[model samples]
Target: MNSELEALNSLIMTEADGLLYEKGLIRKLEKYGDVFISGSYFLQLMTWRDLDIYLASDKMNEETFFELGKEVSLCIKPAKMNYRNEFIGHTEHLPKGYYWGCYADFNTNAWKVDVWAISSKEFEQKQQEIEKLKFQINVVQRMAILKLKNSVYNHPLYRKKFFSVDIYNAVIEDNVNSEEKFKYWLQIKRGLSLN
Candidate 1:
């Protein structure tokens, strides 16, 4: 990662440890399975961005799942909260998984936190796929992915249309640069739905 991203991540980590963990929010969610953090904030080699926290648990039910979501929302006191499931439709290009998530902003920090719940099976499968792709992604390919994601001025429309997974696929499998990948993204972006 670059210096800016590293510094931002360090500060975010400190806040998560001091505020979230100390407030018992992180501890309360420990029963949800091995927590894994993803998204641009953690992976991209660019400027700082939001956080994506996924809890892999097989015990999620309709009642407790939404209840846990409410708990997380209340604990974080985010500025916005949308607890919705986007996998019900648009199954073609979307990732194969069952999840309930909240997209929220805590303050005016140019960053947000997305807390979500996904099944253990789906989580494991996605992790394995990412692990296999990690070895194939060298510095050049990683830069390509980062550049493509940053091309859209970090717009929500761009992220929904051409997510990190889409960028990874284009960079690794198609071996396309940022421009080509972006053109392809524009071609298919309209068909996708925001989660």
Candidate 2:
């Protein structure tokens, strides 16, 4: 691993630990269901202050989920929190579950935490997918992903038009090795013009 990338990952993980452990976020979450920390944080490719947490429970209903959200709000004291009932109105490319998008200031840095309450089946499937990616990503691909992720962190098309998954596919599957190639790949493959 590149020293710079490793250093950044370590720093971000430390902050994440502060949120998950020091703030009792994980403990608070465990009261509701089994907690699984996923996305860039779990993959150790973090380039920004974003956390994706999934709670798996068979008995999670709207009321219970709202209760969980209330607990999370009190715990994080977020500046803003947006709730989404994806189970009722499922969005394409998003998990079929209840979502709580929390934006807060932690350790003097703005952070975004996405908490999803999903079924155990869905959680297992997602974990399988992540594990596959973990095995497929070699050191070269890892560095490429880290660099591309950092470069596109502030792109106009980021999150809204493209996502980290697209970057991962580009680097891992299409062998996109640089920001230039990724931009070209986006244009040709996804019809997304980054320029």
Candidate 3:
């Protein structure tokens, strides 16, 4: 791992720890269901202050989920919280569950926390995908991913025109090793031109 990437990841992890444990976010979440941290944080490829948390429950209803949201609001005092009931109206490329998109200031940094309430089955399915990526990622690919992620973290097209999965695929599957190569890959594969 690049020394710079390692240091940046460490700083982000420390902030994440403060948010999860010190802020009692995880404790509050566990009261509702089994909480599983995922995404960049779990993959240890964090380039920004974002957290993906999933609450697995065999039985979860809207009322209970709202109650959970209420508790989360009181705990985190988020700047804004967006709710999505995907279970009722599932969206493409999204899980079928309740979601809370929490935007908050933690440790003097703005953080985006995605909290999902899904069935254990759904959680398991997602975990399988993450594990596959985890297994396929070698040190070289990890560094490539980290570099590409860092390069695009603040780009105009970061999450709007492209996403982390595209970066991962470019590096892991298409062998994209630099920002220049990633730009070309995006243009060829997704017809997206950054410039």
Top candidate by TM-score = 2
Off by over 4 Å in 3: none
lDDT of 1 by residue, 1-195 (tens): 444434654666665555446656666567656776655434534334456667787676657767776677677665566555544553565443334344444334544566656778777765676567776788777777666655654567755556666667777877877665566655665355333
Tens digit per residue, CA lDDT, model 3, 36-154: 89989889999999999999987899999899999999988899999999977777878999999999998789999999999999999888888888888999999999999998899
Please give the distance, in angstroms, between residue 93's alpha carbon in candidate 2 and its true position after superposition. Answer: 0.7
Q: Which is better, 1 or 2, measured by lDDT?
A: 2
CA deviation > 4 Å runs, candidate 2: none
- Each model's total of backbone clashes: 0, 0, 0
C-alpha TM-score for every candidate: 0.69, 0.96, 0.94
- In what order do the candidates fall by TM-score, top score first? 2, 3, 1
True lDDT of residue 38, candidate 1: 59
Can you list the residue pairs that collide in candidate 1? none
Better of 1 and 3 by TM-score: 3
Tens-digit lDDT track of model 2 for 1-195: 378877988898899999999999999999998999999988999989999999998888999988998999999899999999998887888999999999989999999999999999999998889888888999999999999998899987799889999999999999998999999999999999988
- Regarding TM-score, does 1 or 2 come out ahead? 2
2 versus 3: better TM-score goes to: 2
TM-score between candidate 1 and the true structure: 0.69
